[model samples]
Target: MQYKSQAVAKPYFIAAIGLFVGQILFGLILGAQYVLGDFLFPAIPFNVARMVHTNLLIVWLLFGFMGGAYFMIPEEAETELFSPKLALLMFWIFLVAGAATIVGYLAVPYATLAELTGNDLLETMGREFLEQPLPTKIGIVVVALVFLFNITMTVLKGKKTAIATVLLIGLWGLAVFFLFSFYNPVNVVLDKFFWWWTVHLWVEGVWELILGSFLAFVLIKTTGVDREVIEKWLYVIVTLTLITGLIGMGHHYFWIGTPEYWQWWGSIFSALEPIPFFAMTVFAFNMVNRRRREHPNRAAVLWALGVGVMAFLGAGVWGFLHTLAPVNYYTHGSQITAAHGHMSFYGAYAMLVMMMISYAMPILNGKAANSNKSQVVEMWAFWLMTIAMVFITLFLTAAGILQVWLQRVSDSPLPFMVVQEKIAIFYWAREISGVFFLIGLILYITSFFIGGDKKETA
Candidate 1:
């Protein structure tokens, strides 16, 4: 089937490149802040930089989702997007709004932004409810609703709702739920409650749908696997993720001064969270192994494989490591949490988005497939980033454990400041390792524009 507009995927590709560049810059700033506390502050404070980094990561991944949807929806539904122009308009509006929010973050102080927006970064590193000032908060809501409306209307009018479309709708729900955090009454307890609604629900809940669907799409395309079989696996993985994840929000409540009953609820459900990621690992490899024909995009397949394995390790194994209330009690707000967040989001979400974009680039540009050399470069970048992230996670995990042992567990624990001094080496190690991750990103970004030799189809 012909797409109504030939340029269906271009906007998403551009957004992906911009977001990737943002991710790298943010990484460098955050790494510098770790090693050198007084690095680019006042002009670009660490807190503001972090906000941009984290928020942009989310935004770009969403952009990647939108791109993937635009690229794949036509093929899946056997028709074009209901309105390509509307999709383009939604892209610009969201982009402009996202940029504005970043500017607001830099301009407003922690206290002022918090007071204005209701999101108190000073108190909790910006995990408070969506309470940004009225204008900024409203902007976020409007952008989200507009995006949801566009995607939903497209699906409804096209009369096409496959696994990919289902995932897109799930993403729309995630966007809407995030808006709820903006105005959920002014109680700390309730604020923390709904904050998880946005954070936990998105990552663990709806976004997993996006991840599963994208991975399934790539695997089926590259491996010549039967669509029905691959899609069924997609359904199973997302179903399991939501089943456990909704309850897993209790995990955060363990320390947030909520009911004590959450310890049981959170521990049990979160402990079970790894089951679906394990299923995903099995799903990807099994589909590849069972393929009816070999495809040219071996690198995309490799990335699909990497997503499965990494998701299992990052979201499953590492998550299980701290699922217990007894363990989390000591490691609650430490670097251990950072370890989990980095790997899980990067592995399960970020890399999957990258894989989707990588797959689409060749198709959109009319290349038969990605060049072998570019694929090799991407593979190297994957390893570089993966290994570096592993080192960072290990360093922080060890340091967090040590901190807990010395500061919380010992009979005569070391002073907090003294313990921090002891762990400074790990912080340095983390920063040094981050340099490799940055190098990987550099190579990955270079490859997109300066791609290697193209294959000529017979």
Candidate 2:
């Protein structure tokens, strides 16, 4: 709303929320498939549903990040976007390509889709998160480059702030690290090694920078905190994140045929990964407590605090539970890992994006904040989703603990399938949580249409 060009973010946010709905729907499907393996066996097997579920997560978050950047950059830079038209064009291109990729996943077998999309030339298709075919991968790179170019130019041409600078570093790092996905090695160990460069580094590393910057921006606006004070917190966070995140890559090296020394190094560094998140929690609360003015977007402020606490618990505390070399050795790929992944992602990235949306959407629509009724509804969505995710994580953690006990630690180990049957109850609990999450999402979208008497600003 500060600059005309910021309007471009509207479509991006809309698309992100739309795809988010799709992601949750697919997630419910995957959850059902967990209990009933043949729920959609031939038509939409577990693997495909999972692929769609995760791919939708990555894509929608990207959309949210891009939209947040487009909205924030102009105000931070004190100027208009460098090229709104180009930004809009890239948005459409990215959206179409993403949609087509999902359609491909649903329309044909994985092998056929890979072949049809030139996966033979560069075989990045079979990787866990980088399952996009060559064309889609290429499209992502192009869109990212153009998107970065637009924002970077705008920053260079205008004023630079700590938030914007850190955001640029995070964005640039995101693109740089993604290149590792293309470097698939023939050796399984080496492949896993480089794959973590993309996977682990992303969620734990640069993405945190992005998270920090976005949180700082919201805190500054909502709390009326001094930029200098927030920037100090940002500096400490960036330092801790880099120090802990970079060497923390060793954590994944423990069983991957790496040096024996990594056992000590990975444990030490990865254990410290929680420090930055802890600091982020303190920073969010401290700012709100010291607020200069009460912003009308109380819901946005709630989200800001939620991201802090949830990110700390999900990414920090739960992560620390199994992050050490000793614990991970026993629970390497158990449901515990899945628990960490689900909570950490939702807390850190998903909620951060929603926070940005909650704050910016009202301003974008020419108001300072939505009516109190609308905000109350939004807050309900927040609690429902956050609480539901917590239950999901807890149930998975329980399942993982029981699994590790019965399968790995026991004298007579049970088969994987047998163990899965035992854990069916936990999966059932998680599916019920998923239904609540979907309802929360529905309420979130519904909030937009609910209007009332409110102050209007231009």
Winner by lDDT: 2
* TM-score winner: 2
Listed per model in order, the count of residue pairs whose N, CA or C atoms clash below 3 Å is 7, 0
lDDT of 1 by residue, 325-421 (tens): 9989888877788888888878898788778877877777676466777778877888898888889888888888888899988999999878878
Please, what is the whole-model Cα lDDT of each candidate in the order they appear? Answer: 0.77, 0.94
Which residue pairs in candidate 1 collide? 116-132, 116-133, 117-131, 117-132, 117-133, 118-131, 119-131
Residue pairs with clashing backbones, model 2: none
Measured with C-alpha atoms, the lDDT of residue 252 in candidate 1 is 88
| Candidate 1: RMSD to truth | 3.6
- Model 2 lDDT tens row, 340-418: 9999999999999999999999989888899888898999999999999999999999999999999999999999999
